[model samples]
Each structure stands twice: as C-alpha cells, then as structure tokens.
Target: MTTDTLRASRTFSDWIPASWAYPETGATRDLRFDYMRGFVIPLLFATHFDFFSLLMFVGWERIGIVSTAEIFVILSGVVVGMVYGKKVKRDGLPATMPGLIQRSVDLYRISVVMILLVAAIRYVPWIDSTVITTFFDAPNNQTYQLYPPLDGSLSTLISKALLLQIGPHQFQVIGMYVVMFILITPLVFFMLSKQRVWLLLGISWVVYAIHYGAPFQSLRPTGAQFEYAFPIMAWQLIYVHGIVVGYYKQEVVAFFRTVWGKWLIVASVLLSLGFMFLTWNHPLPHIPQWITLNMIPAETFHYLNNEYFSKSKIGIGRLLNVVVLFISIYALLTLCWQPLNRALGWFFIPLGQASLYVFFIHVFLLLAIMNTPLPGYKDFWINTALHIGLLAVVWVMVKKEFLFRWIPH
Candidate 1:
C-alpha cells in the first residue's frame, strides 16, 4: 500500500464511517462538523425531552418525569445515530464508524464522571449528597428505595467511590445506562454501513419487545436487566435514525418531501396524542366511538385490577406513542432541518451544544434536595420556579463566555 493509503487505513476508521463527520469536501467542512459538536443538535433534543418531562410530571402518581426524561433523550440519541447511518450509506456517502468512535469516547468519559457522582452522593462530604441521593436506588423505585443512606463510615466512603465496585455488594452503577450506549452505538455504524439497517433494527426491536415482556403482560420483573427496557430502546431508535439520515441526506430529504412522509408525520402525531390520553386515563376508550377522555385514574384498571397492562409487555398505546415520537423528530430533519443546507442557526444552539453538562448538573441538583425536608413535590409553584432557576444557571454557566470554559471542559 502507498504511504497515504496506510495512514488512511490506520487513524481514520475503516469501511467509510460517516460523510457528515467530515465536511462534503475540504477544510471548511471538517471545521463545520466539529462546531456542530458544540451546540445546535443537542438543544433540539433537550427541549423535546424536557417537554415530555413536564408532561410526565404534570399530575399525581406518575414516574419521576425528569429522570425518565433524561434517560429517554440520551438513549434516543443513540437510536438517531443508528438510523442515520443506514441512510448515509444508501446515498453513497462514506461510512461514519470513525466519527461514531470519537463520539462514543466523549460519551464514555462523561459516564465516568456520573459514576463518581453516584459514589459521592453516598460518601462525599459537604457537596450535599442531595444531588445524587438517588444514585443507589433501582431505576424505577418509589420513595422508600430512593438511595443508599449515608452512614458516615470510612469503608463505605472508599468503596462507593468507583464505578466498578461501589461497595462489597454494590453492582456497577452510576451511568451504566450510558455505558450500554457506548458499547452498542459503534455496532450500529457497522451494520448501517453494510446496508443491513433493517436487520439490525429488527433484531434490536424484537429483543426490546421481548425484554418488555409485553406478550405476557402479567410477567413480573425478574431477571430482566435495565438494558432492554423500551423507554430506553425508544431513545436508541432516535440515535440510529440520526445516523441513517446523516448518511442518506439525499434520500431522507427526498422521502420527507414525498406524500407518504407528510402523512406519516400527521398520522403519527394524532395517534400518539390519542394514545397518551388513553394511557393516562383507563377504560380503554371504545375504539369506534372516537377520541375519548376519562378523568379516572389509569391505575383503576391497568395496575390495581392486575387485569391489563400489568405485564411488562409493550402495549399498543406505548408502542404507538414511541412511533409517533420517532416519526415527528425525523420529519423535521428531513423536511426543514437540512442541517447542511442552512447557514442560519437558532440562538439556543450554543446552550444546546453543551447539553451533557446541563443534563448532568440538572439531575444532580434535583436529586440532591429531592427527599430532604425541602419545599418540592408538595409545593408545585416552588418546584416549577426551582426547575426554571436551575435551567437558567446551567445556561449561563454553559453558554456564557465568562464561565463557559469552566462549565465542564
């Protein structure tokens, strides 16, 4: 091989990673892609994730909306990349494995810090363990199981400090969910480059479905691991899609303009909203009658009765909601969000770029004071103000020139 060929084979990735990772051609393009690493894309997601979070937290007796929101968006990011990769290859673009690796490394490093924070919540001194008090608990726990209570013991302090072994019996915790993404995202790049996207998606989805135990609905949460949960899987779909779209810029944009794309978007949205309403309220709404709203609690039938939806299976409503969400996000990129064509940018783009910092900080702050005798959970107005206030602080720290370097560099 020629000297030039040897270098290309080694440092960059093999199998044509992603065209989007590099500019279409020369120096300017490469720089532009790098700048993207800084902002705009992350914000689009941050808004959407938080939007759902607000919805999830709207009333009484629901999961922790903010935590669920954070995990979903992060997982969805992986899905976006997976889907985008396939489209890129079909459009005759180069592969993006090398770029994907670079991104994965960035994510891994972030996970490391989150792991440490989880440890510190159990042992760190004055930083107020409140930020990460819930780190020790299972993902979907109620009040009593929030976290490992701090014991002020030396052994517990040293043991819980690392991601690998928190204590004698502690499993690898903290951002292990993110660790799952780092492991699997590169595989997406590999499959997509080979035009085997449907195969990969099919496999992932089936695994996801079985993992959900939807077919058995009455199943209990036994050996089920956190990796296969649908809420997380739904997010993974987003990252896959982004990768596919980036790969097949021409094809995706074309599809968006087609009538089918428009119809897909509309139908998905209407159905998603309808499902949301039905899931929140039980009674299943007679399908023939039209959109129905029952103010009664969903638990009356689904959980309390142990009749339907009690199983871990992915119900029609939840699956459809996932589909609707997926198509809507994709539709924007295909239709108007032609990232390459536009020189214009949104103002929140900068803030969005440093999204991980915001995400980590926001989670830490919320959990820190979560269970203390603080004025949250019960005080709706105060909690709303606090959430908004936290957002502002993070925005300034992350976006403002003065403290930007110190935010999390």
Candidate 2:
C-alpha cells in the first residue's frame, strides 16, 4: 500500500456516504434506510388509493412478489436490531427492556386509535357509505374487513380493538408490529446479545414452517371474521432475518466485499431482473394489450402468484424475491450513493425519518380523498396529480415536523 494509493482509497471512501461505506453504529441515524422508507411511503399511498390511474406502474405487489409492506417490516426489524442490539451489547438485555416495552405499548396505542378512527368514520353522516362498501365488496380485500359492521355492534368492535385483534385493514401492519414488539423483538435482542444468532433464526424458521400446517388468524370478538391481514407466525421470518442481518451488519458488509459475496450479488441481480420481466404486466391498472409479454401463461402466473408468492402467507417465492431484490438494490445504492443522494435524498430522507408520522397521517388523507368525488373521476392526469399532491402534502408535513411533539414518528 503506497502512500498515493492509500490517499486515493481514502478519497474514494470519503466520497461515499457513511451509511453505504459502513454499518450503522447507532450513534447516528442511517440516511440510506430512511430514504428507502421514504420512497416506499408514496408507493404505499398509491396502492391503497386503488383507483389511481398510475397504479399499474407503482402499486403494491405489482413489481414482483414483493410489496412496500415487506420492505417496511424488514427495515423496521433491522433498525430495531441495530439500535437495541447495540444497547444490549453495552448494558445487557435488562437495560433495553424499557425501550422495547414502550415501543410495544406505543404501537398498541396506535392500533387502538386507528381502529377507533375507522369506527368513527363509519358513523360520520357526511362520509359516504361507498367508502366502506367499496372495500367490503372486493373479495380479495375482505380478509382485513376494513369496515366494521354498523349493526349496533360497537361493543364487539371496541373489545376487538382493545385486544389489538382488529383495526383498519390498511393499518393492520401496526397491530402486527405491536405483537412482534411484545413477543418477538425481546427474544431477538436477547439472542443477539448471547451471540446465538443461528439459534434465533432456527426458531424463527420453525415457527414459519408450522404456520403452513396450522395457519394463525386474528379473529374478531365474535370469532366469525378474521380481521388480521398479516399472519404473524409466517411474517416473523422476514423480520427475524432482518434483525440477524442488522445485528451482524458489519460482518455482512465485509462478506459482501469478498469474492463469494460478489458472486451472490451478481446472481441476485439476474434473478431480480427475471422476476421483474415475468411480472411486468401484472399491475392493477391495465396496460395496453399489445404491450404484453405472455411469457408465462396467464393461468400459470395466477396459480404461481397465489400459491407460491402469496403475501399473507409470506410464501416461498416472495421470500426469494425479497432477498434478491434487497441484495440487488443494496448493491446498486452502494455503488451510486453519492449521485443518487444528491438528486433525491432531500425529499425522501426527511419523509423516511418521519415515516411513522407519515403513515399515520396518510390514512386520514386517504379517507378524506375517498369521501370526495376525486376517486370517482379516475382520469390519468387527475390520478397522477392526486398522488403527487398527497406525497407533497406529506412531505411538507414532515418538513414542518407537524405534531412531532405529540405524535410518534
């Protein structure tokens, strides 16, 4: 290592963002993950909006087997591990217990509030019944049962909400997180502290496997309706894996710099592209008939997507897709962090930093939009404008730190 060579290395390394060049040390927030979360926020809004004209290009589960929900969950787990894993390492598991408990309680509170909000909306005279009916009518959307029945069953609804068993379908992930924080996250932190990472993963895999035979459901108080969207037993695999990777982030990064790691990155890139090509025409909004590939027969595609890549079950195909997509995207961002950051970091980083605030507020925005005639119009330009306008409003709210003092972000 000559002095000139060392100088060049230092210069190149300095040019890269710290988040890309090194693992998070929990001393400072990692902007890269925040940016990814920020990026996912609008996609989430677009997907939920349903009739948005540009949904085919940006909707959930449209790109491949993956969705923004998966990204959010995995990134959340990674962050929990990075932050609390470090704490456990320094002060032991007991010291980090309060933070975990507080987080779980906060998530539970949010879930309850969201459930109440939806219930309140159902009773609002000005808000049209169409808002509730639209979701109720959709067969695929029935799983979460977004709207509670108005048949004078407030007691059941409130009881379920208090139990964290039911909520707005869109906010179901929050309820799932409430459970994960309470039951799973502490064990993850403990295992990481004990350096029993493989043992933790083995247990997670076993739970995920069991979910296949005995699928868990979040039944309502009456036990007739399964209101939970995410099956915790299955989805925990992704979250647990994220915690392990985040706990060993430095080691993982080092491995990726090795020859075997480079090979794995190349393989991931190829697989991701293949998945994208297969699903290029699978989005909600219709593409021109002439633009179709027809590589996989329509029947075959549907069967594979439903059986092997199902979102609720966190199916095998989705599992594979997320891993490859993460690897490919992580590598691309690492290589081009400086250029990409300069171009888009300003907008996304702030939103990502305040993602919880955005997530909470966006639900209200969507509800308000639904009550209007805007979604009924469904013009391409109108839909595009609506999506951009919604994102900008959220961005401004984030910039102003709207309710930051009161609301958890």
Candidate 3:
C-alpha cells in the first residue's frame, strides 16, 4: 500500500478503538436499577390484581413475607439518594434542596391527579360505581377502593386538598411515598452534610420500633379503620437505610466482600429461611411430621395467622426477608452469566426507565379490569395472557419514552 494510505488507516484506527475494546468511563446508564425497577413493577401490578389468587398459591404472600411494596419504597430511596446525593456532593445542599422539593411536589401533584381521575371514573355510566368507592373500604381485604362521601362537605374537600385525607385504597401508597420523599430530601441531605447518617438511621429505627409496638392513628384520614395502610413511621427505616446504601453503594459493596459482611449475609439468609419455615404451610411437600416438628418450634409454627409477619405492619420477618432477597439478588446479578444478564437487562431496563408512566398506566388498567368484571378469572391461560399483554403493552409504550419524554429532568 502507498505511504499516504497506510498513514490514514493508522490515524483512523487510533481515533476509534477496536470492537473488542472496553471503555474505561464505565456504563452511561446502570441497567441494574432499571431492571430491578422493572421487576418490581410487574410484581406490584400482580399484587394489586392479587394475581387472581395465583400469587398466593405460588407462596409470594405466604412463605415470602416481603412484598413488592417494600421493594418499591427502598428503590425510590436509592434512586433519590444517588441522584440527589450526587447533586449535594457536587453543588452543595443549598442548590440541591430546591430541586429535590420541586420533584417531591411534582410527585404529590401526580398523586392528586391520580386520585381525582379514579374518583371521576365513578361517574361513567357503564362502569360500576361501587367498584371504585367500595374497593378501598377495608384495604387490608381489598384493592382499588376509595370513594367520596355523599355529603361532600367543604371540610372534607379541604382536608383532601391538604392531603390530611389521602385518596382511597391503592392510593395510600402514593401518599406515603409523597411524605417519605418530601421528608427524606431534606433529612438525608442534612444528615450527609453533618456526617450524621448513622444518627438519622438510629432515630428512624427507634420511630419504627415505637410505631410498630404501639401503633397509632395517622394524621391523614382515609375513613378506613386504620389511619393509613403504609404507616410511614415504620417504613421510613427502609427508606433511610436505602438512601445510605445508594449514597455509599461502592463502599457498601466493598464492605460486603469483607469477612464481617460475608458473615452478616449468611445470618440474613438463615433468618429469611427460618421465617419462611415458620410462616409457610408445608412449603416442602411430603415432609415427615417428625422433621417438621424438629425444624419448626411449637411457639413459632403453631400460629394460625402470620400477620405478625404481615406486609401491612412491615413485620420483622418481612423486613429480614427483603434484606436477604435484595442482597442475594444483587449478588446473583453480578455473578450471573453475561449473555443471560444482557438478555434480562434488554427486556426489563426500558420498563424501568419509564417506570413512573408504567406505574400510573398499570393502576388505571388494573382498576378498569377489576371493576369491569372481566371474564378471565377462572382460566389460567387467559390470566397468563392478560399479564403478558400488560407487560408487553407497557414495554412498547415506554420503549421510546412516548409519553414520558417531556418530563423535565
């Protein structure tokens, strides 16, 4: 080849690395966050729908004490912590606080709009009004129920406007999230600035303990017997701890490799298994009565109800189950085969990226399905198809950020 041709080829090669080269700048986006969020979104949808009792039969509720609700909350904390924590680290809290508050306000506004939309649906002639109104009556035993009083007094409207009365049923989680985000924005940043994260965490745990031990009425009124389903005082422990982890994710992961961290992981796994054994009903088929007797103590296994390990109260068993699951899942993701990881990431990451839109859309869809009395209740195949369609539709809608592209950073 001519000298000039050879020189040009060399220059172009230097400008662009070979296909095999791996860049040192790292990933532009962490697909793990999106994938995890995507994973939680379907589970959340299924829980809302009760998976037509399939989830119960599969032991998602019984043996697995932790619910997707907790995962969603913790993930929210992690995302907020990473995003706002970096901003605070870079620009200082003074500059970051306003944006944090603004984002919280945006979430609050979205929630209010959601509540109003659900309320208005009752007026549609074909749709069952009771479905919307009575769904949240006893949320522990129900889903998607919230209704405005017939009187609609000024006092009631005012309280609703102030969020002292959060909208019904599934909407309760939105309110808890609103409170958590607003409170954590300032609290997490301030704690970080003062290097008092541990102190903040300690206080959070104390509040959880007190709230769980002596449950109290919340300021918010939903007309349900309980003040709020989520009970923010206890759930905040998960939120705050998530923030610390997200803020110091690298450090935390490094610590997990240490002897103490490994031991802790082992303990967490064992505790989770013990809870499953105690709470589940014959999780392992055909086990000997003698073996069951030895594995599960009389005090632990004889209980009729597992509400002591319930999702509503954020029970101790539930908390430990999630901790172990979260850690184990994280470890598995890192250790999994590369091809499988890429495939899984490809499927879930987009849904996670557009999670906010997906969440809003799914709730509306589920509400319609539950209220309309759809025909697929008894058919396993139909239900499976419905779920697959739900995920597929959301995936397609969110793939290009169709409705969410305009959301401000």
Among all candidates shown, the one with the greatest TM-score: 2
For residue 45, model 3's alpha carbon misses the true position, in angstroms, by 2.1
RMSD of each: 11.2, 4.1, 8.4
The TM-score values for the models, in the order shown, are 0.59, 0.88, 0.79
Candidate 3, pairs of clashing residues: 135-145, 136-145
- Please report the candidate that would top lDDT against the real structure: 2
Which candidate order results from sorting by TM-score in descending order? 2, 3, 1
lDDT of 3 by residue, 78-109 (tens): 87777788888889999998898788888877
TM-score-better candidate, 1 vs 3: 3
Off by over 4 Å in 3: 1-29, 53-59, 136-145, 150-155, 158-164, 216-227, 269-307, 371-373, 405-409
Runs of candidate 2 exceeding 4 Å displacement: 1-28, 129-134, 137-148, 151-154, 215-227, 283-292
Q: Give the TM-score of candidate 3.
A: 0.79
In candidate 2, position 226 carries an lDDT of: 24
